[model samples]
Target: MDWLRKLFSSPVPLNDSYHLSPSYKVFTSAFDQEILAKDLERSRKYAGEPTASADRTWRELQQFWATDLALLQAETTRLAGRLQPSLNLPKSSTLTLLIDHSGSMRGDKIQLAAFVAEVTVQLAIKLNLPFEVLGFTTVEWKGAPVRDLWSAQRALSNPGRLCALNHVVYSDFTDGDHPNSLRAMFLADLLKENVDGEAILWAVQRAKAWSAGPHMVLIISDGAPVDDATLFHNDPSYLWSHLHEVIDEFGIDPDVLLAGLGINYDVSSLYDTSDTITVFEDIHAKVLPLLENCLRKM
Candidate 1:
């Protein structure tokens, strides 16, 4: 009963004096250090040199031996097709991470989302890829609209700093150290409110302006888009239609890749055209594989 009451309650006003720091913290004791370390190691293993384009030359033929044996005899040798690399990712592209810091993503869900974001930043830096990390909740939050954890410009200039996880788990409201932490704090404060998934479109628009090359947006969330502030009507399909309109406005649907990591609910609808929306079960066993596969595609 209390939980339901709190869910419908209005959010408190933001503090004007509170400011998010420019420098971010690389480590935090809020989460299990061992798990974080293992995830980081896994990201490193997956961050091998970006695969080159397919090589169709005879020297690089995949079935050279078989072809030679057939050529020696009177039998005609079948030409071996080009060997495509295991992971042919884009060399010059922008990687945008959109984390859902809504009330539903509290407890273990939020922690896992942060871990995924952390590992992604590390992997992007390791591969020398330009990237941006953004966290979004309600539009009424302090950094409302969207909070930038690491901007594309900052990432390109100080790639070395991004090699480590620069985020903290905010289980409390007053725990604001960096911009990312501040966003987490705001999310914690309003931990029972509905989320606005359309915030992702805002982040995507910002990322497009940041880079002209190909862009990949990965959204980590637990629930569907349900913002009473914007969608006053009781239609459930409004979120879906709104998202499609936003994507159409950009006109970069093909160039932009959308991937979703749904925590509990089936968020596949949120990414209707995406082939990479995976329902979350276990982070290490389920989510990691999906994330790696998406990265390979990028």
Candidate 2:
């Protein structure tokens, strides 16, 4: 987890011309096959027997698709070389990431989320993207307000620092419903008061600003927004109003948001590909294209 800063030497072309390592390709193919098989088996059992065990098996598969595969792909990409032909990427592109730390996020679910979040920021750094990470929970501290929140400070150069931040954030709580209200207020203040909304404003004044031109916000959660209504405006049409605030405050067009809805608690749909991976594929398919479109619009 060392960090190196250098110009893109053997620039990769923008036509999706990046190549995968032979070892990586073989490994991923094998892994995909195994996952596909387990998925199929679980589906068959649930289809034939309709038992709770069969249902549980199906849910596991869904979690893997929704979280694990994304992390694996990201980790592989980080280990791989960055593409060149230089898209003139911003020197720093702010990536503000928030992962759920609620008590409910224990066991394999949290493990998977942690893996994905870590791998993703790692890849972003390897590609020389500037980013920040945060974790939240409601578990109280002594003499502290019920809504008190904490965050790992922003780092400018060290990838290991980012990784370290990831570890600290994840380590703070055990698995439960540790949602903190003060965190949201802090985030709002950060967005509104400090950093001028240059990057994604976070809770407190602990904003992560990118030296790069534009920024994006990435959130990984279990569809549980602690202050969902307040975070955004109350209007239903404004699904991502806070996002809009970032865009306006920064005056950056097409600020991107990439989110992975974390593992669902209900186990019934986990093993079902049709119910899970299909949705994931739909979302995954949209990401690259959406980013490309945003870049163009910008």
Candidate 3:
């Protein structure tokens, strides 16, 4: 695997100020996640305003995933309250929808992602389980100030994750955000560079905090982590290794159920359990097995 080759290689050292950039050697702490979330709030000024958050743009968002969403809702009805069948899981089994807001997921992929989120939320509500919808993207397209700071430094060979990341919270179990409000996540301007490792780690922390027992986290992503600034300065596989490092760390946790639903892209190597689904019809069939597995695990 190309990732394996990049794994053993060393990152080109950089002489810049410390920020959210983290090396593969260190473990991500809860404090780190909090700091990053606060940083994203500070960086929101650099990103575009989310009209969907303030206005009723869900009408338009509904159209993108209408076909798939309708089919999924029907399926939910057919299954009734037996989504987990004989499992009889309690309300403690939380569900976290971790969405990738990278530019690569711009068109049909994003629509499919919305459909997936809707289905997950529907099932969670049906089973009376808690659920949350979260997304991740950079504040700036090119990673402005972070990149600028690196340039001001010696511009060394590698600078990890120079981008100013912006993590999103559309809905949470506290009921702070309504289901309709999740439409804000798929806004066009919100699509930017994605740091998969950072987003996944963030979601893992939140999901763990919400649930007392087993928690299922479905990560919707199209491809590997990609940030021009981060890649240009660091090793080609900097983010890739980071993602694996994070996944491998948490993948073994028996209390956390994790799976990746790729957008027409097979992510078996990236995740312990993953499946691909296109925007075309029959998405529900492909996704059902993963959801079932999560239930069984509980």
The number of the candidate with the highest TM-score is 3
For each candidate, give its TM-score against the true structure. 0.50, 0.38, 0.78
Instruction: Provide the lDDT at 235 for model 2.
Output: 38
Clashes of 1: 0
Model 2 Cα RMSD, 1 decimal: 20.3
lDDT: worst 10-residue window of model 2: 23-32
**Candidates ranked by lDDT:** 3, 1, 2
- lDDT tens digits, residues 139-253, model 2? 1212011111111112212111000010113211121122222112111111111111111333212322223335554444443323221222233322233334443444433
Candidate 2 lDDT at 217 equals 46
Which 10 consecutive residues of model 3 have the lowest summed lDDT?
Answer: 25-34
Error of 1 at 197 (Å): 4.9
Give every collision pair in model 1. Answer: none
lDDT of each: 0.43, 0.32, 0.68
Question: Number of the top candidate by lDDT?
Answer: 3
Q: Compute the lDDT of residue 86 as modeled in candidate 1.
A: 53
